[model samples]
Target: MSRQVSKKAIRDSKRTFGNQIIFWMFKILYIIYYMLV
Candidate 1:
């Protein structure tokens, strides 16, 4: 049970990091679009 919980936590942290990366990518794209306009 403890092992499973640790695995889940790791998976969750990775997912959270992925989401943050995606969010930053979108923000950067938006800034580029604004600059182009």
Candidate 2:
């Protein structure tokens, strides 16, 4: 049971990390565009 819970938590964290990377990538692009403009 504990192993299952830990596995789920790891999966959730991996998803969260992916989302954060995508979010930051967009944010960086926006900043660059704003600076160029």
Candidate 3:
């Protein structure tokens, strides 16, 4: 029971971390795009 819960928690955290990294990548790209315009 506890093992299943921990696995779910870890998966959720990994997903959130991936989303954050993608968000930052897009933000940086946006800034660069505008700078060149």
Model 2, residue 35: displacement in angstroms? 0.3
Off by over 4 Å in 1: none
Error of 1 at 28 (Å): 0.2
Worst 10 residues of 1 by lDDT: 1-10
TM-score winner, 1 or 2: 2
Residue pairs in clash, model 2: none
Tens digits of lDDT, candidate 1, 1-37: 9999999999999999999999999999999999999
Name the TM-score of candidate 2: 0.97
- Which runs in model 2 stand beyond 4 Å of their true positions? none
- Residue-level lDDT tens digits of model 3 in 2-28: 999999999999999999999999999
| Candidate 2 per-residue C-alpha lDDT over 1-37 given as tens digits, one digit per residue, 9 for 90 to 100 | 9999999999999999999999999999999999999
Q: What overall lDDT, based on C-alpha atoms, would model 3 receive against the true structure? A: 1.00
Give the 10-residue window scoring lowest on summed lDDT in candidate 3. 25-34
